[model samples]
Target chain A: MRRLLRVSSFRAVLVYLGLFLASTGIVLLFLHGQINRALTSNNDKAVWRDAAMMNQSYALGGLSEVEKLVAQQSQLSGVGVYLLADGLGRYIAGNVPAFPAPADTQMQEEGWLHLRLQAPFAEARARLVRFDDNLVLLIGRDLSAQQATMADLARSFFIALLLLAVFGVIGGGLMGRQALARVENINQSLRAIISGDFSARIAPSSSQDELADLEAQINQMLARIESLMLAMREVTDNLAHDLRSPLTRLRARLEKLSLSAQKTGQADDIEQGLADIDQLLSLFTAVLNLSRMEAGTGDMQQQKIAVKPLADEVMELYQAVFEEAGWTLDYVVDKAATTAHIIGDRHLLAQALINLLENALVHGVGSPPHLTLSLTRRDQQIIIAVTDTGSGVDDHQLAHIRQRFVRLDESRSRPGNGLGLSLVDAICRRHGGQLHLSNHRPSGLRCEICLMVRE
Target chain B: MRLLLVEDDPMAADLLIDRLRCDGDIVAYAENGEAGLAQATQDAFDVLIVDRLMPKLDGLTMVRQLREQGADTPVLFLTALDSVDDRVAGFAAGGDDYLVKPFAYEELRARLEALMRRKQLAQDTMLTLADLTMDVIARRVTRGAQEITLQAREFSLLEYLLRHKGQVVTRSMLLENVWHYNFDTQTNVIDVHISRLRNKLDKEFSAPLLHTLRGRGFVLQSADKLGDL
Candidate 1:
């Protein structure tokens, strides 16, 4: 739950919902105040008009005329209340049965008084006017109905605001959840790609909304990255190939001189020169091949080949070399995956496997000389691993070994361009796979290439 | 062999031409594809070695034109572009062989010799190097009366060496022609396989048919030719 709230989408939704809640609350409060003010003003205006009329009636025909008008208006409900009282604080003939005690002697002193006309009557806003000969008139509208209606409106507004708040939070949370799911899908693919599966991509969602647009934009970015990676790789490969030409001509001239110098016995120095040139050339070629595979632009004929036979073929090719080097060659295939197949370029995969085996033969020939090649079927993957029972590489150096031109301290004297594992890593990536190097238990190094299998 | 060399680098061309001449072959030099096409058309050459990038006409277009004109002289592209796509493009333009530049002179000579010999050899089932004979149809090998048993890869390696019997077959050549690998490994894995194959072919024989030349490559020569060299 905390994780969901921490997601950026969820937090944005929360912020929007909070703003909505506050705005709606303010609007509801303002609306309630406006309605209350209008109702009170209308009540006050009716009271003022009744007061003027009562005073005019008193002027026209004295107390009897005022009393008659009050008596006539008092019979109607929700109209003005009329309380005609003598100076002794006793009620006369009017709708109010008794004079309110607070309005007894101070009738003329206060201009307006809010008082209950009777014990059961609603509150009223009345004007206290002194008539001739100390007679008092209390006239105002009953506020019960207006007050009830205002209360009802206030209740409905609060209910509506509450409901809106509840639904808004739910809708926003649901939206955030949906958006987070799609984003997480994209994140999963990007993570896979970061972990060396360059073929990975964001999975598209169902709706053609903004999230879909985002997915499209992100997928476009990945496509561009993939292409740029290829172009960079091509540049390096072209550079290597270009370098080879002049170097080749130089070596040719050197060989010619060396052949002529054979009479003076200076050919040995030239042979060393030629050897250095060959080393440079082999390194150049290795880099070119590695880049070509990484670019994924070579003529790779992908086909569905049974996994075991492919492993068998590579093992057959390397077994003789291992035996010649006095290393025991062992092979194993998981019985369950005997019929497993993978879609890949056969020769490239074979080369990758051979490179691993050759790496063992070159660097892993320690005290107990043993190299094991195994093929196992994993979930939607085929793992080809070569383990050498020797002094394994340090845990720190194991990761660096897969990078280009990264040779360990001990293997510096070995006859490698230091691109063996690098090329295998590139080939595995091209096949939509990964290469994992780990120090095996009891002094050995395990190099595993996990390749996606053909369904 | 009479060879036509089309190259833009003057020094490279001179060195290559001089080396080819020292190996007892007649050579003609063309600084560009235009001159190369003219020379190829004017004279009957055994092989045409053309550089890929040149002025006036590129190697591919020139080769395509030569092929269109019904000239069957084998053409080899000596280029700096070693990408698989580049090689495919070279062959698509009717090139018989493609060798990247900065090559061992021996390798270049061997490829040309192979190209020329490819035209001379008849389409026969049997391939013979003195007493050793291979039946291409049966995938069998026999030396005199003794039958030789071999693995599939070993058989292919032996077949390639026997096809270019007396030529200096470089390791890269064997890797490309036999194993179909375009890259080189620092380890001498190919040499190991070649040594094993040599053992099977010459272990019990009187005169070794397969011979390795230091600073060059392996050559399978008949007993009579061995003394001549």
Candidate 2:
């Protein structure tokens, strides 16, 4: 019984039964009150009528005749009459061999009828009358027959209540069990999915219910996932073709050049060939790395990397480059113990930062020719800023800067494929972070790499 | 160097044949696995370079057949299949090295050299580079005859840098080569060990060797900017 109530649907059934039984019980109580009143009053009238007829018989005949009838009244059926006179107050007639006077006293006096209740015959009625001042006539009927009828009614009502209780319990249980079975089936399917079987799905129900609708929705979600997987595969195939084909051709060409230089003993040709090949390989591999980052590979290596020190290191390494390039380099590292830790791969992070800084440096020599690098932490985020007082970009150009191999220069070229900001964007996203670009105060393009500070 | 180059695609075969000859390795090129196997039975080479998914016979099946017949020549696989599972499959079929296609000529040359060198030395080996020597069995190192103590990881790091001496090994290279972790190339373990390694290599010496090229990566060499680089 305890376990049955533990199920919510089962508990709901019990609550329904409780409400149902309470209302039915109230109606039954009201009906029982009405029936008892009506039945007792109805019996009083019938018994009174019979008592009046016996009184008439007593008045017509004298006491001796009455006495003789009374002596045989036990043998006589239907009504019983007993008479008690003024002086004796003893039984003078029918079925009362001894005096049991108090019950019929009210009937003996007047027209009012009385019903007396005793152990077995709870519904008994009587009436009496005084005839010529010397004799009293009493007629009373013990309604043992009426008592049996009321007992039968009570028994039948008990049987009805018993059957209702038994049937209600079984019906409620079956309904709860059916509902639970559907829920359990859905739960099993969901568990299978959680354990990595994305193909697992809830069994569809024939009935058009909310459960069936939920199953249909889950299947739709799974379809979307499957399509995404297919798209990823297609991208990988295209990457292999486009990146590797040119690379293979370029490598073969370089090998032939080197061999020719060796055979011909041309010193300048050897040096030129080596330089050109190195440049091509570097550029190709960089582009490949950037594309790979963009395609959303798993970021499996993550650790607590202190950002300020890392940013400082990059600054130090490039400081000489910045100075020799005739750019005024400025830096403002936060003094507020800005050693914020973030979960990331250091090399990837460094690569992205290097791209942004180099972009700033290259852009610096073009216009106002000054660069600024800053690292700071604010509100559970690590922000590294690389600002250059070059031709600061407008909103449109700022958005375009992160597109693949996008360089806005109409001049010869900017040393790279213009993928610096794009690589920055990709690396930030891999760390559950983002790259935000905005105009620095009055001048310069500010590249902000915001990452989740490790807790 | 004598070699067998097996490839199915006509374009790929022509390019590879030209490149290997330019690299000055005597090459035997086969377009199918059957012809390649017949050549292997008739001749011996320094290395066997096979391409996967060939006509009539796949590369892995041919390699397996060769191994079954007690042919023990070192095999380097070249395939267009880039998936990690494909690599495992290639190696499981008795390949000695796996190279995804579109490789740089220099990378190919370096790998082939390493393969041949390792074969000559066998497994129980101590390795050496200019001014640095390391015992593989003892896990010990000495630079210019001066013995140095290093952490276990530091020893491994130095060993890797020394092995690939003069080449500009990227952080990714060190991560995979020394740490046996091919995946996460972004780890700072490479950076930290490079720092520790520089302190031991050239901190007390006249010049620093582990030069961190600005946007590139760490390279193991002398402190001065090498004129070629």
- Model 2 Cα shift for residue B142 (angstroms): 4.3
- What residue pairs clash in candidate 1, if any at all? A248-B102
| Cand. 1 Cα-lDDT | 0.82
Interface RMSD of each: 2.4, 7.3
Residue A18 in candidate 1 has what lDDT?
Answer: 84
lDDT of model 2, residue A125:
56
DockQ of each: 0.34, 0.21
| lDDT (Cα, tens digit) per residue for candidate 2, span A1-455 | 56455668888887888787778777776777677768767766765665565566666886665556556654666544344444355656555444344664345334644555433334345655566566665556676776676778777776776687778888878877776777788888876544334467778888898768887887788667656745765676566555665566665666566656776788466567656755665565556556656654422245689887777666655565566566788888786537678877776777778778777766644464788888877888878888888778877887888887777786736566666677788888767789999987677788889987886
Instruction: Identify the runs in model 1 with alpha carbons over 4 angstroms from their true place.
Output: A1-238, A291-306
State residue A9's C-alpha deviation in candidate 2, in Å.
7.4
Q: List the residue pairs that clash in candidate 2.
A: none
Instruction: Give the per-residue lDDT digits (tens) of candidate 1, residues A37-105.
Output: 898788888877888898899889998998898888887765577889888757876788876666542
TM-score of B chain for each model?
Answer: 0.95, 0.77
